[model samples]
Target chain A: MAYSNKARDFFSNELKNINTAGTFKEERYIESPQGANINVEFPVGAKPKEVLNFCANNYLGLSSHPEVIEAAHQGLNERGYGMSSVRFICGTQDIHKELETKLTKFLGTEDTILFPSCMDANAGVFDVVLDKEDAMISDRLVHASIVDGMRLCKAQLYNYKHSNMDHLEEKLKETQNLRLRMIITDGVFSMDGDIAKLDEICDLAEKYDAMVMVDDSHATGFMGKNGRGTHEHCGVIGRIDIITTTLGKALGGASGGCVSGRKEIVDLCRQRARPYLFSNTMPPVIVAAANKVIDLISKTTDRRDKLEKNTKYFRDKMTAAGFDIREGVHPIVPIMLYNAKLAQDMARDLYEEGIYVIGFSFPVVPKGQARIRVQVSAAHEKEHLDKAIAAFTKIGAKYQILGKKKDEIIAQYGY
Target chain B: MSDDLKKLIIDYVKKEYLDDDSEEIDESTQLISSGIVDSFSMVALKTFLEKKFQISIPDEKATTEAFDSVNNMINLLKEFNVA
Candidate 1:
């Protein structure tokens, strides 16, 4: 088969434009497992260096936890490797049902259904439940998966300004005549570390006779007091109609997600959702590991508490050092740089100093909101945080990003 | 009224899309093609224009052809007799 010139030209031109725009995403090879410290190889064949990682989604530090590893190994030995079929056919296992039930209990939902990834779970939701007569009012800054999912549905879509309850209310009022109205938003926005006003949203939903959905990916394993998510944090756990979350982040840092909601919704998704109906079920090892993660978190609050402490300490230290940290209790802390090139430069400098972080600009966030999104995890100890702060102070002074003088920063932060 | 509408659109685009007042914007600048305004922002722009100008922009007319550039948006408003 030969390639068409039109297709070749279109792709090549697009790649060229991406490169020129400085938005070309390049992958860095990680030579070790995900954790607080990992070896990263920049260029192929180059020596990998162990850098303190601050960009991973390992909020609970279970990605490389000994118990998670042991559980995975045991699962692989007992359940074998892969389930060759989709869930309805032959892939449903005892562990899968156990994990789903555990998730339902944890999330305070009536039932749960697993997907290979949260993206898939999101992709499968709207089309199955909503139709042309229904209306979906989404947050403007909801995750990309939600946008893509909405595109597949026949529902009349309306987007309100990010986290603006007034705008949401206006949209809801406009959509009053629709057969079904649903409001969707991320529980904790990954970019700015801001939690959505779920309490207010629930109130509005009740007034507008609408249902509410939340994607709790960023808040799943370590957000609330018991780690139920933003709904629990906002005291709207049972009030929210639907909740979707991931095991790929704080759960075990592996790949799996679930939509936990009304039993009827889960039943319909199992019957009609394209992703769940067509895609293979989650592997036994991931299912077993996720189950172990839920069990561990259920038993004790050690990891979540550590993560909270780490987040507060890092956020406080960074802010007191004259860094403009986004105000949030979430583990994700965005250090605002405002300049795209400067953010890239700062991230590179931080990486060179053996502190691994990534800069997000443009398409990831709004323009002029370029930032280095630092994610704190329980794996990071006092020494790790101190080292990262010292490195940031040094680089901040070099780049003149610190609001005050170097002496002032040191004097204020005790760095 | 037309000039005011253009200024309003340009100012909103500058503040929301470009996010930099220092960048120059012209009537013929390619907003969608150049990635200055994305799909989400396009919807937002449509909603803003509809509310501000008191014109209903149907779903079919909310494409790059109708709203990609300032001149195109003005022409779209003119079609609705709101420009």
Candidate 2:
């Protein structure tokens, strides 16, 4: 009774507005495990349909791998199901320590500290390391989790243009008066799928006496030559002051994250990061599975190489199909459909055609930049890619959008 | 600032943000305050202004109030000596 109808009415009206905007998100039920192929049921009551998943974050296709399953099983056996307490409590296990050591080696960082998720890592990092006297300069397109973390901190926050190094340098130059300046960016922007210019960021950081942080969640498992991450890809591995990433994506598609960087910074994270201190520690099963994943990627580049090849092939064919695919070498290929309703309609149509991809609209992306973000995975073979490309072409033709530009598409479907 | 400069700014906003080419805004219309352009678009517009005018409008000077309208934008540019 204390929770009034006024509050209820507010949320109801807000949801109605969202529905009217054609941007209301609905979750599809998935019966199977996460992978390139999943059994999905849309709008809740419909029978589940077997669909080729083109929307998952399973970049390396290891989410449902037999070896990964076995490792997870082994882990569940060796170290029970869950950690009932936080890390500083009785939750820290031997496997957790082992995984940290392996991650440190794999990442080429001096130290590493684990969190329940990368969101937790981002949430806990800033307030622990920075205060009002410091300044945090973020790329305009950095992940939302980093933005939320910044909101919780008292530091002066500024944003440079997306991937614009000159703007970043200018911000850094002007912020030299602050006690510390931290330049933060995502390794690969999730929407645009463009790689960050980390080498230039590092040079600017050095010139301005600033620290650098990269939330390399999207690029952690298969970015560089050895898959160390964007730092390795950009040839600035040991120079990054803080490297935050996740195990929830390509690493094993389980849930865990870490803040890995300078030994002292990680030490401070362990001692002070609120999420690590307050939330329950990462489960031991994920630690054991992540250990196997790190070991596998460390020994072989087969999966990542396959992923890269598959991505390039898919991108080339999609471009040839005349879809307005965002130009990127990353697997997060956003097919730009400027209208929200068009994006949703295309996604629904593609789902009916047995391809599962989600449409992203405003506020997930900027207004008028709505699209269907197709995530290409290594599990998909040439047949899958060909079928997906054919499906897209057919759908594009149906919508009369195959050969259209942004303005043309917008004219057909309002932005 | 010259009337030509204000027209140029208004034209850029119409082309980029209001691409429908139907809705109109004069020199005194609210841009940022009325949600015609958000912070992200403001940065993009700031980038355009900087490149077009060859002036560095520092982040602090490019406030919401400064970018709220074509008139305010012109005033901020006037401080930068962009006529």
Task: Output the lDDT of residue A339, model 2.
Answer: 89
How do the residues A22-45 of candidate 1 rate in per-residue lDDT, one tens digit apiece? Answer: 999888999999999999998667
Evaluate candidate 1 and give its CAPRI docking class based on DockQ: acceptable
Task: For each candidate, report its DockQ versus the true two-chain complex.
Answer: 0.23, 0.09
| TM per candidate | 0.90, 0.86
Name the TM-score of candidate 2.
0.86
Worst 10 residues of 2 chain A by lDDT: A158-167
- Candidate 1: which pairs clash? none
Q: Which stretches of candidate 1 lie over 4 Å from their true place?
A: A4-6, A404-415, B1-37, B44-62, B77-83
Per residue, candidate 2 scores C-alpha lDDT tens digits across A1-415 of: 6779999999999999988866677788999988877998876999999999999889999888888888889999989999799999899999999999999999999999999999999998998899999998988778888988887888877677678887788788767899988999999999988999999999999989999999999999899998888898999989999999999999988899999999989999989999999999888778888999998899999999999999999999999888998898899999999888899899999999999988997777877799999999988998999999999999999999997888899999989
